[model samples]
Target: MGRPVVHFEITGRDGQALRSFYTRLFDWQIDADNPMGYGMVAREGNTTEDGVGIGGGIAGMPEGEGGGYVTFYVSVPDVEATLTQVESLGGSRALGPEKISDDLVIGQFRDPEGNLIGVIQAMSQSA
Candidate 1:
């Protein structure tokens, strides 16, 4: 099967402000206890659902980074293998095969035209 765009992120200099704006604008549910300066956006009436309607986060930009950018993450079966494929296709690793949880690994890369893209590997239910 082909990879599917599974997630998205919006990074900015002010995470709280961004979170507030999005929450008000979309009526999303954003909690205040994001230790990483990241806010999870839960759509109304579907807060308990998993993988519904393009899940997203609002993140604070790292120090020295100029502005905000949006990134979309594609779901993959294997992050390391996808990184190799990205490199072979003239892309370059931009972030990591980093673990977000015991069941999720994520990575980012720059495409040939320098667009930042993300990939995620979600562990199987039987894993």
Candidate 2:
């Protein structure tokens, strides 16, 4: 099966401004108490019970970074193996193979063309 684009993030110099803009433009519900100045966005009137929507976040840009960009996360079967493949294909790791939870691991990389992308591995029940 092909990897699926599962999530996205937008980073900006001003987290609150970005959040306000998006909330006004898209009517998204944003969580305000996130510790890292990140806001989680929920689509307005979304009815999916399985969390199937293309949910995303808005956050302050990395310190000293010149600008911000949007990043999409692709779901993969194995983060380490996929990162190896990414390297062999001339891509480079940008962030992690960090474990986010018991079931989820995520990583970010820069493609050959210098675009940032993310990969996620959600462990199966039997894993």
Candidate 3:
């Protein structure tokens, strides 16, 4: 089966301003209580009882990164292997199959046309 697009992120220069704009524009409720202050809008916050929409995060660019971009993450089985396949398919690694936590590994790559994309993998407990 093909991988599924799971999560998304919108990063900009001013996270609070972006969060305010989006919340006002869409009547969304964002929670930015995390250490990074990344505003996260849960899927249930936007989705219907039947589950219609994907969850996403809004945040500022890392310190000194002046610009921003929106990217969606595709769920994969093995992030490192997927990155290798991405390179083989003309896509170059942009970030990493880095472990964000014990359970989550994420990576980013630029497609042949230089469009950035993200991939995520759920680490197996047995690993």
Candidate 4:
């Protein structure tokens, strides 16, 4: 089977303004109360197997730091292996197979033409 694109992100230098804009523009329910101030768009009933769409986040970078970009994350079985394959295919590693938590690992790469992409490996509980 093919890998699934599970999440997306839209980030810029001003996260608060971005969040507010998206909220008014799309009527999206976003929660950004955490320490990272990453606005997680509410999935509603969309997180279940019967759900209709994917979830995503909106974040802001500190001044002169965050470059504005939009990217989606593909769910793979192994972050390291996928990134290796990506490199073999002429892409280059941009970030991790870095573990974000006990159950999540993520990475990024730039394609041959320099399009940034993200990959993620989510460990199942049974693992």
Q: Give me the displacement of residue 28 in model 3, in angstroms.
A: 1.6
Error (Å) of candidate 3 at residue 7 is: 0.4
lDDT tens digits, residue span 53-80, model 3: 9998999998898699999999988888
Which runs of model 3 end up more than 4 angstroms from their true locations? 48-50, 125-127
Q: lDDT score, residue 32, model 4?
A: 98
Q: What TM-score would every model get versus the actual structure?
A: 0.84, 0.83, 0.93, 0.88
RMSD of each: 3.2, 3.0, 1.6, 2.6
User: Candidate 1 lDDT, tens digit per residue, 24-86?
Assistant: 897877765656757876544534457357677888888899698899999888888889999
lDDT by residue (18-69, candidate 4, tens digit) is 9999999988888999988999986674465777788899999767875788
- Candidate 2: count of backbone clashes, pairs at least 3 residues apart or interchain: 0
Q: Candidate 2 residues 1-127, lDDT tens each?
A: 7778877899888888999998899778878685676798755454368755777778888789867889999988889888888999999998779988898898999999999999988888224
Judging by lDDT, tell me the better candidate of 2 and 4. 4
**lDDT for position 38 in model 4:** 92
Query: For model 1, what is the error of residue 80's alpha carbon versus the real structure, in angstroms, after optimal superposition?
Result: 1.0
In order, the Cα lDDT scores of the candidates are 0.83, 0.83, 0.91, 0.88
**What is the C-alpha local distance difference test score of candidate 2?**
0.83
User: Can you tell me which runs of candidate 2 are displaced by over 4 Å?
Assistant: 43-52
